[model samples]
Target: MAVALSRRTVAKNALSQLGTFALSGGSKAIAAIMVARTLGPKGMGTFSLSWTLAGTLAFVAVLGLDNRLIRELARTRDPRELERSLPLACLLGLIFGGLLTGIPALTGVHSDAAQALAAAGGFVAVSAPILIFRATFHAREKMEYETVTCVVEGAVALIAVAVALGAGFGVGGAMLGLTAGRVANLILCLVLYRRLWGPVRIEIAARRWLGLIHEGWPLAVSYSLTATFLRFDILVLAIFHPSAEVGMYGAASVILLTAPLVAVSFSSSLYPILAQAEGLDDEHLQSVFQKTSRILIVAALPLATGLTVLATPIAEMLFGSDFGHTGRYLALLAWILPFRFVNHLFGVVLAATHRARSRRLAAVALALIANLALNLMLIPTWGAYGAVAATIATELVIAGLLLAGIRPLRPILARPLVEGALVALAMTGVVLVTPGGIFPQLATGGASFAGGLWVLFLWLPSRGLAAFSATEQESAAAA
Candidate 1:
């Protein structure tokens, strides 16, 4: 009964995470379209660069403490202990945020006053506390609460940006509104957390800090390296290429990258569940891992293939003809989805098994190698296309290396790879036979994609979605 209840809890959390992704991704797509139209490529490029830098800074500020806290609190189940630790986490974040902002300012990376880099920096600093508080909700498994907060935050950010733009604030105004909305979200999250968990005790202990750091530092290093590799292309483009090129690449990246969000949502929800289930036998753990891998692969493959086939029309429809070139990039990026999804599953498995150091080492080595090789090989010759190729190559390497680390997950990944190839073949055939027009292509392509999914789901007995049923087979397996 306890096991059943835990499984249900995890499922519910996964659903909530999926909801958050859907709402946030939808809102962000709309917001990006509007922002691009208003600011044009140059302004969009400027904003993208600033936001990227801010994200990197924010990452450094948190230093993986939130992840460490979640893992620890999952074991301890002591609300009071978590409460006491929250403020300390927030303080550490703020200090880190301040340092991130101050260093950038001193270096003159953000020289223009109109750009409001300082204001953005301040917002990033305050955001640390908000993130710490939010992490507490996850630690407690109050995922419904987390979902609601995510929805509200996304909605607020979207509405605020629209209003700010309408009020004639341009990009600067948009930034201000986004910052304000984030602050509001932080406050609300803190209030709700306090109400539900009681006033968290504020305590700072060297031992506690050291413990978290020991666990978190590897993750932080891994994340930083990975992020740098993934994001440096934009910075490179902003310097070497035109704002228009950056805009096109950014647009394509935004759409193509949405494929991974589903995988991420599933993995995020699965991690804590897997961690808690560590007491289970190795066979059980392997079984669960295999099941989850199958589901992720099955889901991610069809979407990626469909997107790849329909990349041109979709890009045009989403961003207008101003982004015609984006389709090619989107198509190129589509191949990385299956690899990334499988890689993410292995990563989660490693982290949940407390093998983060090994995972971090693998990630760092790949990131470093990919960054240097890709930048040298791609950026100089092919421009954005080169960058896209570099990205695909890097992700493939990362995925390959991570898979090498997890021998158990390899067989599970093979089934999905086969399914993905089948789906891609179907999509290619449809694209070839369909008429040239966008609508015709879309209609035939959509039908073919749906058909492929139906076949895959019916024919392939994935263990992940098997939980959705309670038939004779599952009963037999359980017994």
Candidate 2:
């Protein structure tokens, strides 16, 4: 009965994650399209500047409390710990939100645009504290609560933005909607947390909070690096180019970055299991790491292929000709999908193993340094295209470094790396040959690739191209 309940809970959590992504991805797409269609490139760029900075600031304020709470609570849920975290988190969040709203000049946007950017940035900070509650639900594996809250947030943002646009509120209006949505999201999450974990309180103890901060500081550094990498290209581009160029980059980015959302969801679902498996034997742990790496690599191939093939039509359809360059940017950026997939698996492994913190941090830190230097070298000459180049290169190097840290992972990566590349190549060929609108193209491309890969693996066993296979049950057991 315990095992049965565990399996059922895992299934529910996976479904809940998928639902959350659907809500988040869909809302973001709606918001992006609306911004592109209404505000044009320059306007979108201004918004992105504010929004990105705000995210960075919020990360600063949260101090990695979300992950820390989840990790500790997953170990053992103590009411005293929960009570302490609630107030500490709120206090830190308020401080961070104030910093975000207080500083407008940091974005380098000028005049009226700068003002709009400041408002957006402030709102983003205001919304970030809700993650503490979300993490609590995650630790308990009651993702259904967070999923509902996410949907409510997205729905509220969309309605707010639509209403604001109709009323001619422009960039500032859309930002206000996002901020308002965050409030609603926080309220819902807080209510749910109370239902499951009880009411919030403030019983702060300096020593305890300090200890919590010490425990989470590494996470803070790690998350900041990760978040910065995601937005670094744009931040650098804004420095070297016009708002319109930044907008175009932002447009492609909104879609390109969504590729990792699915991978993240998968890794996130596996995280608790892996964390709990720390005491397992070496053979079992090795098996877990190897299988997870393979799964993510294989999953990334078709996605990267399909998205790359569809980039042009999707970009044009979504943003029109003013943003035609976004397609090429996306195509070039598509390869990062596989690299990012591998890196996420590495991250979960690192987090689970618990000894890889310094190594992981060093690898990402090096990647960031390299990313910035490359952007400086390339962005001036190539603009948005340069940013894409930096992105692909940085992720590739980061994944390679992390893989090197996990000595046992090389062999696992070796076979799938070749297989995934070959599969993606086959997928690319099919997509190129079967030319049509989105649906027909996707259908033909997907079928042909799936059929071709199926045949290749089956008939050419000597080629060592046997498909990596794992049932969900097998993967769960390995974890």
**What TM-score does model 2 achieve against the real structure?**
0.87
- Clashing pairs for model 2 are none
Model 2 residue 394 distance off true place after TM-score fit, in angstroms: 0.6
Candidate 2: misplaced stretches above 4 Å? 1-9, 104-112, 279-282, 414-430, 433-435, 446-479
Candidate 1: tens digits of C-alpha lDDT, residues 252-362? 777755668778778778766666654323565677777778877876777777777788888888777778788998988888887778777777777666644565467
Superposition TM-score, candidate 1 onto the true structure: 0.86
Q: Write the residue-wise lDDT of candidate 2 on 1-479 in tens digits.
A: 00122556656776788778778766766887898888889888877776677656666677877777777787777756666676777778777776655556566555645566556655656555687788888888888887899899899989998888779887777777777777788889878988988877657786799888888777778778888988888888988899999998898888876667767776677666566654323455566566667767876787787778788887878887788888988888888888898887777666655556667778778888888888889999999988988988899889888877766555366777677777778777777777576777778777866675565454666444333334555777889
